[model samples]
Target: MSSPTPPPPREVLPWSRFGEAARELARTVADSGWMPDLVIAVARGGLVPAGAVAYALDVKAMGTMNVEFYTGVDQTLGEPLVLPPLLDTSALAGARVLVVDDVADSGRTLELVMQRLRAGERPPAQARSAVLYTKPRSVIEPDYTWHRTERWISFPWSALPPVTATATDGA
Candidate 1:
């Protein structure tokens, strides 16, 4: 027997809109007069948006922190787990930092990242967060957000299933 199909996403963020959202989020940050010296992306989901925002803000320094939280659609682990290839917090010292994520849904991941970034002897002088979307129930509200939605979101980068060897065999 086959597993049940997941329901369609309530909101679909196309590639075009993703670009716009990144720019808008960056604008919010710029308007606030807090330009970051470095941009740290919450890897996997946040990589794309972080790059876009960094480009928009002309921030040359960038880093990534890999965190695994959501297991599947609307599914999650008890808490977020930081994956390997960890970011070097040394670079954050005395620099204005911006943490970028695709969405601040549960806010656990963001909270964990923020804590880790702010801990230790060397921490950023000032740290802020940015996201394309934020849920109402989020534990931490990001400094800059492009939209707020409670329903499932189909991000352009994650909308499709992973490409397997079989899928590429004939192509």
Candidate 2:
């Protein structure tokens, strides 16, 4: 009988490394002399890193743009969709903002967010992007990226399966 094929290899980012990476990324922005007034997280992946970067940079103003793109590993929707609990565009008006995400796998999600951020009559004074990882096939390069890899990554936060409710009745 023929054996089943092995799964593809993936890069793993442990929690320990993630903290250092996020700090280093924040330092990159600081060294660039580009001080953003606000930091925008692209939820749900960007939430963690954005908070880290914002804290590191001492940027008090923070917000989130909820976008759902990836359905599962190597799976994506036809296009990215902006979910509800949307961020107010007014916050972008004349403000220097930093957009943060976990990875730029396809770059489509980032593009969509950028387009929307710049759409309204009063767009931010400046907008930049930062990410923990960048894939080889990504179309848009982030302003700050800690690592570049072609392999799928197992981020510490997402490596585990979602938590399900426990049965109240004992088996």
Cα lDDT of model 1 by residue, 1-171, tens digit: 999998865878999788888999999999998899999999889999999999999999999999999988889999999999988898778999999999999999999999899894799999899999999989998999999999888899998899777755985
Best by TM-score: 2
Tens digit per residue, CA lDDT, model 2, 1-171 = 999988789999999899999999999999998999999999999999999999999999999999999999899999999999989888689999999999999999998888898887789999999999999899899999989999998999899999776786443
Residue pairs of candidate 1 with colliding backbone atoms: none
Superposed model 2: Cα runs more than 4 Å off: 168-171
| lDDT (C-alpha, whole model) for all candidates | 0.93, 0.93
Q: Count the backbone clashes (under 3 Å) in each candidate.
A: 0, 0
